[model samples]
Target chain A: MTERPDQSPLTSPRSERVRKAAALTGRSARRKQGRFRVEGPQAVRSLLTHRADLALEVFLTVRARADHPELASLAAEAGAPLREVDEQILRAMVRDSGDGGGDQGGADASPGAAVGGALVSPQGAIALATFSAEDPAAALGAVRALPADGPVTVVVLHEVRDPGNVGTMIRTADAAGADLVLLTRTSADPYSPKAVRASVGSLFHLPVLTGAEIDALLPALAAADVTAAATSGYADSDLFDTALPARLAWILGNEAHGLDEATLAAAPLTVRIPLAGHAESLNVHTAATVCLFETLRRRRLEA
Target chain B: MTERPDQSPLTSPRSERVRKAAALTGRSARRKQGRFRVEGPQAVRSLLTHRADLALEVFLTVRARADHPELASLAAEAGAPLREVDEQILRAMVRDSGDGGGDQGGADASPGAAVGGALVSPQGAIALATFSAEDPAAALGAVRALPADGPVTVVVLHEVRDPGNVGTMIRTADAAGADLVLLTRTSADPYSPKAVRASVGSLFHLPVLTGAEIDALLPALAAADVTAAATSGYADSDLFDTALPARLAWILGNEAHGLDEATLAAAPLTVRIPLAGHAESLNVHTAATVCLFETLRRRRLEA
Candidate 1:
């Protein structure tokens, strides 16, 4: 992962390496090159700390280096090359990063504009990580081998399209102490820049296996002895009143069209977050957070 | 406020009224005209239903009127003139709408791009409404007049800059049965296009008063006999363990800078949501939802 350290900072946004890094914003380039970019200091810091083995390179403006002095040593310890670049390079890197195919950004779209305005200013740091796509079968096998001392919670996103929502759910799942996140193939790419930015580095916190099929995942959960729980607006059981299983997989549906009827019927439990007011439903991220935290709260009370 | 009925559909994106409607996307124009634009069907529907008195005009494409037949009667009942428009006009209105001063949108920025990708395809409907600014004092007085309810919950956002976050908080506050949401002067405008879109029409479901000062609001809350509780990352009291007051105000801080020391010290109560995982903190909306719902959960249990 180490590159030849040239003392002079990389200043050109049009440089070959910068262009290649920027291209990773699109899905095809990331898929073809087997690497994805993590923007912002928080995400880069997490990459250097947790998944250093996957860290390919770390780029930062001189000011960012001054702001966070420890990043240099962190990158050194992680065996990833640390390069200094100007703000323009950082801006150019995030500028054209598509919104994970939601809307096409204009050719002249400003820096960080492609991320749904999730990030306004450059955090002055970005890093590249080799995409190690986790297989659901292998991930489930890992979860199955865990000790049975307490309940294990898995968050499954089924065909959720928004990268920001996907990233936020990953962060919230981690915050709720969930074990793993499994995403069906139609779900947003967790490794996208928008997702990584929104995750605030939680993508590296736990095993997030994408490319799942609900049909295959349901049987896989059964094999692992994990109970499947789906959230539906019309569900009979209220989330607050229902007693969730010890080993649970909480399935969330798409943003526009929720879980299909067959999948909803297949789940062992379907619960709704009771709305006390006139809102038709909660945002997907909010619902997921409420659901995951409720599970955590229950476990805490049980303890 | 009704425009003359015209049988011909609005075809030009460059018409005078269209330009004026598009200008409401900016703060100065909205302030000058005393009107804000609400985009998408959900928000427009809520506006016509709850605050129809404020509805100035409704614009819809030919397909939108057909798709949502009820909108015509709703507009008729509201006495707001409904005008048919083309997709281009709908697109034109949303395009170049600034991102509430967060960042400048380019001249060629696509439709709905200004909203942080909150809305992708136009919902084929948009409405202009008189900006009715709610007074915090009067709103608090209304809350005071309510019967000794189970619990009166008010969500306060202090200098939070994100329009989407503000909108989501409003929606979540309504969902949790909160009485009102007050925003400090430095916070994003709840009537902004991004906010109205993100609120999913919940803005019409409850009273949201902006332009508050913490110093004044603290005294007002106290005088109203509402306990002001501020959420802090370092607070000692866990949200679950704390016994809240019958009348409560949940004060949330800015995304980057949290509640200032003075504000935190002045609050009657301070509590933290116990994060079970490694996240530094929950997203503002997620935190607000958890805090508000916990209050509701406690009240439900008591009932």
Candidate 2:
């Protein structure tokens, strides 16, 4: 096992630029720089493997190096520059690089104490990599681009703001072999740390298209002969009873508010997860998993 | 709508004693007082409906009163004394109520801001009520008490400490119409605010038996002729292919570690949720939901 050396001199202009670019916290800044920070060993490893075509910059804390020796080798395999810092500094870096907020300084000052009990340490390691920005038009084209041999399944999330739920849905959609995961305007950024963490690196593998105009997407879905299946708490049609189409776009909405009237109008079919218990509804993520897996099961049965 | 008058004046020596008893914030204290704080409107409503027989006292902030006018009527219908305090004081009360730490003076200092976002504000209201104390003996009896007609499903959570997940499981178990929800010694308190909130009041509807000695409960489970179905991420048997018994105890483990070897050994059946995607594992809550609902579907089909 090649041990990661601490403090590689931060010399190259590109390396400096990538590091500075990774530090950009604002969503707009990240988009402008064409770079984003991926954290945790599993996520970083996944990004390195599946997204090897993209330019990657890796950073590891001393603790992370001790815990994951293979990470250094993996970075080398990808021909990426690697650097190590103290756990405190790494934590400060994560805090600085976090979504802009009032608690940035306080979080950095406190360091690992905040997330001390969790498995992935706040101060562990992170990777700065260029994510191929999938153009919405291109992503839509890619949906159209799928082979005509089977039905295509696209996931459309409307105002589902919780990143964890969104991320889990995308991961579940991928697991179920869905074609695309689309996010509406009000949805949390698919790349947000929480969403990425929940997705368990599936984000890198899946085609995630965001900021989609629902009006345009709906018509395109229709033109592609894809039916929109809207999930609702009050829908009369039971989810298990619905005749699932091969090419379907499953539409899920906010936890508090179901699909808006316009979205519902666009959806040709609506289904409900039958609830017998006292709970009014399932957690959005859990519901999504249930629906996606059901679709997967149906497809398998057909095959 | 009948307005409940300021209740500080109605405080009796008995009320003070009950308040002091609940102030301890321990299992013993909750058991001794036969009362525990149910934070937030949803929990309060749940308790009000299902556990109304144990109604004792209700407290609320003026703001809480405004937000939930039905609370006043519910309290009145239950014949529980209702009290109102400054919003700041209510916020402090709830904040202090948890873990029994925090300055009460600070609670009353910023009344409106204090209660604004918290699950429960001190000014919002506290209720003194009775809960049926868990008697492992009684739970065992209930296991024995299952009717001979239909299959009985019991949910056993082993060391699953996330309060929210535990709560959600309890709710899901109830939703699936499971017979009981059991917790190992290490699992979260089913009555904790977060768990209660996540359950959305299913906690009261479900028969929750916690803090069991696994050594004692294992044999009882065996005696009930309930097949133990342990969930694993990498078990040999696919969950969809498994023959789910009519009488089954589904064992779920902690978020990080799945079922322990001993627990797995105790299980006659082990099932895995197939992950076709790259993600390492499903969220514990999502996994539990999938398993529980699968069992429900299987049982229904068999019926």
> Which predicted model would earn the best DockQ?
1
Model 2, A272-301: lDDT tens per residue? 887766776776666777788778767777
Model 2, B160-191: lDDT tens digits are 86565777788888877787888877786665
Question: By lDDT, who's the top model here?
Answer: 1
What DockQ would candidate 1 receive versus the native complex? 0.47
TM-score between candidate 1 and the true structure: 0.92
Residue-by-residue lDDT tens digits, candidate 1, B1-303: 334434565778887767777776666667777888888787889999998988988988889999998888999999988988788888888765444333222321345553432346568998888865646565555546645645688898997877778888899999898988888878877887767877899999987787777787888778778899988878899888899898899999877678889999999899988887777888777788888888888878877
Alpha-carbon DockQ of candidate 2: 0.30
Instruction: After superposing candidate 1 on the true structure, give the runs of residues whose Cα lies further than 4 Å from its correct spot.
Output: A1-11, A97-109, A114-119, A134-136, A146-149, B1-11, B97-109, B114-119, B134-150
Model 2 Cα displacement at A263 (Å)? 1.2
